[model samples]
Target: MSIQEKRNSDFFLRPRFSIDLKENPEELLERITTYLKSDACIYRSNVADKHVFIDIPVRKSHFWSPQLHFEIVKVDKNSSTLKGLFGPKPQVWTLFMFVHFVVATLFLGVGVFAYVQYRLGESLVFPIAILVALPLIWLLLYFLGSIGKETGKNQMKELHNLLITIIEQ
Candidate 1:
């Protein structure tokens, strides 16, 4: 199987891969199920109602890890296209987005308030300090997200291997 993967630095951007397989969708799905069940690591796997979701923790009990999704679309009677996406868990992604939003809103609100106070000749030191700190916090969060991605890098590779092995077979 030939797989092409795309990646980006943004935390929200997930790595996606596309591959064409000689087998039909059902056969591909069967191979994936077999692989997941035979793997030693316990994965939260679900396949029903034409939906597939797999959660393989990078480490057992770890708070964060990437999720893998697969969809098989039949292109012909003997060929199918497999699409794969790898990203962090939904809750973790949502929480990160919420935190970033809060930081940005606070920064803007305080910035405007600080500007008004400055126009009225009030102290700028504390407001400026806070305004400066918010961006720094945001940057720190970006770095932290990068760290989280790095921490899960190995698991990402494992998931990729699992997918490729099943598809190639």
Candidate 2:
């Protein structure tokens, strides 16, 4: 199995990859459905329209494992474009996005307050400390996300391997 080029940013928790297959969209989807049935780790496979969604429950971990989604679009009579995305459950992903938004909004507010205080020649110590703390919290969140990514790395590989195995067959 050769390494597949992942199309995700370093800071992103969701990873995606795409490739062209020399099969019609229907044939590709059929092959995928057949493979998912035989895969022990995967449960709850759903295919709708041209997309496939699979649930991968990890062992001994309370957190939800990342889901795998595939979209197959026919390019011609004998070719199709396959795009895949691997991501955490919606609740987990939304929580992370909410945290980021809150941190950024609070940081901006604190920075504005600090600037205003400085212009008035007032004490800048407390506001400056808050300004620093917000970003530290943001950085901490980033590192935590990175750690989460690392924790899920192996599972991600498993999902990718399944895709490759099915496609190659």
Candidate 3:
């Protein structure tokens, strides 16, 4: 019943964790499949090979709903390990990453142009403003991710509890 928390970077919106289990890998997968398929489950789930994905029901979801993804790794013949992650939906993750990439690219491009303007003795106001603003925007993105994680905190706990229950059984 020991679940150890691994502190990945403090800003990581997607949290990764692992649990040691005494059951075999196949048995763990089978248990997740069986539980997800049974009537007692309130969540939606997908099982493929050694991986399992759990989602909140659509009727009770929001723009920041969390998803649980886990993989069972074989640890010798008599035991297995369950590595799990809690994150936003793939599309949302992609969107955030794309925005970050664009912001970074713009920051670089704007910085170069601003430097050129400075060297040319032209107006430095606009590019300097942009340079300052880009970092603020980046910081905003980080805070937004933190806010989103906080928004989905309860669901994260629910998903985690469900995984613990499955693994403990």
lDDT against the true structure, per candidate, is 0.76, 0.78, 0.87
lDDT for model 2, please.
0.78
Which sections of candidate 3 miss by over 4 Å? Answer: 1-11
| Rank list by TM-score | 3, 2, 1
lDDT of 1 by residue, 13-56 (tens): 46666676777778778877877677563777777644567787
Off by over 4 Å in 2: 1-12, 37-41, 58-61
lDDT of 3 at 55: 96
Pitting candidate 1 against candidate 2, the one with the higher TM-score is 2
For model 2, what is the error of residue 68's alpha carbon versus the real structure, in angstroms, after optimal superposition?
1.6
Which candidate ranks first by lDDT, i.e. highest? 3
Residue pairs with backbone atoms closer than 3 Å in model 3 (clashes): none
lDDT of 3 by residue, 117-159 (tens): 9899999999999999999999999899899999998999999
Q: How close is candidate 3 to the true structure, as a TM-score?
A: 0.92
Q: Find the number of clashing residue pairs for candidate 3.
A: 0
Instruction: Give the distance in Å from residue 154's predicted Cα in candidate 3 to where it truly belongs.
Output: 0.3
For residues 30-140, could you state the per-residue lDDT of candidate 2 as single tens digits? Answer: 888877777553556788889988766545333646778889888998888888898876778899899999989998998999999999999999999998898899889
Clashes within 3 Å, all models in order: 0, 0, 0
| Residue 10 in model 1: lDDT | 47
Q: Model 1 reaches what TM-score against the true structure?
A: 0.77
